[model samples]
Target: MALEWLVINAGLSLPEGFLAYLPSLDYLHDVQASASSLSAYISPAVKASLFILGVVASLINASVIPSSLGGPGNAVLEVQAHRGGLGHRTENSLWAFAHAMEMGVSILEMDTVFTKDGVPVVWHDHDISPEKCRGDFVGAYIANLTLAEVKSLSCDGQLAEHPQAKIYQDARIPTLEEVLDLIECYDNKMVTINLETKLDPLAPNETLPVEKYIDDIVPLLERRGFASRTTIQSFDWRTLIGIKKKFPKTVIVALVELETLMSINGEYPWLGGLNLADFNDNWIAAAASIGAEIVSPGHGFPWTDTIHTPGYEPFVNEDMVKRAHEYNMRIIPWTADDEATIAKLIDDGVDGIMSNYPQRVMWVGREKNRYVPRVGTKHRPHCLVNA
Candidate 1:
């Protein structure tokens, strides 16, 4: 009934840079859902005028201005590069994070699992994947390898099955501090790290115990001065609970997927003794109970994505979005790459998109009038990535 102005602004630090007062939910949804409506309905002259208006607006706003775009109240859409743009380069390598930072990803989404000596290193699988890495160190569990042994391997850059992936044949598994130090050098305060604990609840022996993360991981982040800029996420809620009880101020993200939820087994201790059944099976409330500010569900979780298999329904639809906000929690689903799926997530009003290809998501956000984190030119160290 009323027009609302969503002033999507960035003051250079907080990820919450974009802000817009939407007129109505229905209106925003209508606009987000209509990706091609402008080309279909608007005249060429008007489109050109809108393009020019957008250029001028971008000077005033970080994202392309909404005045010429589909709808009003286009707030910030946080774009996270899964495994720090895994689709672009090697997954979780210093090379990957640096490339993603250059590409303007709001969050460098990487997995962190403990090494044999209790040092936290950035790696996705507890057991190293043969497809992604190669060396004498291949086929060994990351937990069995000391930090030095893990670092000796070179990345093959074959992750996520992206065929055209730019391979950095010499890339190595970066320690958690090395990854953060790379970001520290880039000096982009707007960017953040979504560091996942990468622990599997069902297989506890493969990864280190939760206390290592609480004792070592938290302090590392704190010392780097990135404590305020980083988010600690995990599928196993055990570590999340530990961090909350000890630190009490860390930004905790409770991750949910079919496996972690124990979809077949009912209540299991995946959620740090807080069962989903106890919260009426509402994962949002379960996450909120632990002082989690964000609840990240697997994309199209509990079901599956139609992108891979058609006719499958997504779990993060409109109603779920409302339910998440009701608990004062944000829903940032994971690692989707397809354009149609990405647009649908944006339409669903998810706070962010964790994608292997963040540039594609940013393009969609621009088309849909959401905050696309400004891409920065590289001033990073030359010896690091050898561009």
Candidate 2:
């Protein structure tokens, strides 16, 4: 009977040496099966071996299997709501930014273009586009328009086409001060504010006096007690340098847009004739020389080889990231909302990502166990999402 039990336990086969132990295991089972048949031949050593095997199996099942099922721990990914969560509402409107706060991203990224009245308003493009602004205001220029006039134009043009943004229709173009109010009202410090300086790129005459504009905006942020949490960024190195010199303690980031630079009146031939290749060596160096700590370029510059130039390979590469890091500057890529593209950027070790959909980036960070959650979402004014 002991031999039979051992053979069954061993799946009817055993090594030659283990075959000798089979008789012993079978005897122990037989003795245990019936108290009346218990025998002194059953050794405590065999009982201990069986107990140890059970313990080992339990440990393996708990540690190995659960770990395999759970996969990797959560990773932290810097999630900057591009134009304040373009996913939920119209991009850059006060309502949209408020919505982003509700989504609980690590950063609130918004563009600042001076109104004709010299007011620095939060907006992305230098001029309003047909895609975002519908009706008579579709192609109107932003720089030439006053804050009141710009406010009158609705950015929720896509609302009819995309119902998710229905609440965005009445959204107004919020002033820099208004954004600060939202931040302060929530008492949210985990969230950082990234303000993009959208200066005149096409209409050279529309440019604002650099120092004066900087003074106006910086003071407002300081007055609101956001100087420490606020980060000023611009594609124009001069603006960044000016802002840095005036507010030396404030965090400053340099923004780079590849397509805009390549455009006729954009940053490249229009602003400085420098492309992605010359950015790190020349453009980025200039900002770094002025003590700029963060550099945000288009994500395509670091990952893709497909140049917008037909039949031409992309000039941007991983070398750009290495060079930026060596300078002790953080690299935060811009405007990538797709999960796959964002994952690639995070994997490439970017300091942060500027995405329209901050939620996706936030989840990516939470999944990787490395995220720092920001302030209240536009959905909930009092809660924060932490990773």
Candidate 3:
């Protein structure tokens, strides 16, 4: 009966006596037979081997097969450009965003802060630092300056720590509207945006009120028709919950640091007054309760060094990935730049990775046969308009 089913559905016939050596499928009728129905009968180890072989074959032939058939493997892990490829360009600059798009990033990760006049702008830091920018008004707080005032600062200088790095000139702070316009005009229309709302718990007045922030940004996203293509992320869970209540369909990413989990004193402000201990440090469950479909945890880099205690463990591990997957959540770690670490994360089964150098991540993805091609445009120059 199994052989007959295979011949009818898959167009393949086994030897006449194959069924004699095969295990009986008393429950076969309960299963839906498909092209890859044989996978159910195979051992898990053999299934995995077949999947790897299929991926290699597809890569060699330049064709993709449905993952259900064990063909091109699982869904492609998303490669997000952190602050628009900050490793190679000034963080959050338009040029950096364009460069990342040219490199074929799956998603552009950035931060949003409100200008003094209540304009949403693309910037990472709450307070301007002279290390990344140079202007007449250095060390100014972003909330205190108008959009025009913010634009006067040039983020073209190389970081003093990395003096040998390339420097770009005339790159000024950009409004959220400007960035959305650029993404729309970009030839590759499939690239998504992961915009983080920069809110300070210690200094709430320095940023827009939670209600005001939602009111200001959601409309902009809807007007730009990016409500579907953007994921609103934040360390502050309150804002995310607020956004979820308002825009139910819009995706939200819960960003976490080691402090969020390891706060023995329960003093972490990013949790929005929720105690990690209450959830037994299961941040994934905590995020899901608030309607987050994705969780972006900090990569356990030694330099960050937040989780080095005797019992402390990296937040994004194999168990976390498995648990997240069980709940239909994605685990995409942040700012992984080193090739070795990126390779390890891919091995650990992350849904995606946010990196400062997207090119490096792309290379690793290709090596692992996990590279997801861009949705539009095959070839382009480094700049958007020229491309």
Instruction: Tell me the spans in candidate 3 whose CA falls farther than 4 Å from its real position.
Output: 1-74, 160-165, 262-268, 301-313, 375-387
Better of 2 and 3 by lDDT: 3
Candidate 2 local lDDT, 338-370, one digit each (tens): 676666666666777788677878777655644
Best by lDDT: 1
lDDT of 2: 0.61
| lDDT, model 3 | 0.70
What TM-score does each of the candidates earn?
A: 0.79, 0.67, 0.75
Query: In model 1, where do residues sit more than 4 Å from their true spots?
Result: 1-74, 263-266, 301-308, 379-387
Residue-level lDDT of model 1, residues 1-387, one tens digit each, is 011122112111111112132111211222222223323455556555554453344335322222112211126788888988878887787878888877757678989999998888888888877787778878888888998898788777465568767888868888888887787666555567889997776777888877788788888888988776778998888889999889887889988877677654556567888777788878788889998988888777433354456566576787887888888777888877888888988898988888888988998988888753353435456638522
Residue 102 of model 3, lDDT score: 61
| Candidate 3 residue-wise lDDT, 112-151, digit = tens | 9998899999999988888888887788888889888888
Best by TM-score: 1
Q: What are the per-model numbers of colliding residue pairs?
A: 2, 18, 0
Compare candidates 1 and 2 on TM-score and give the better one.
Answer: 1
Q: What's the residue-level lDDT of 22 in candidate 3?
A: 27
Better of 2 and 3 by TM-score: 3
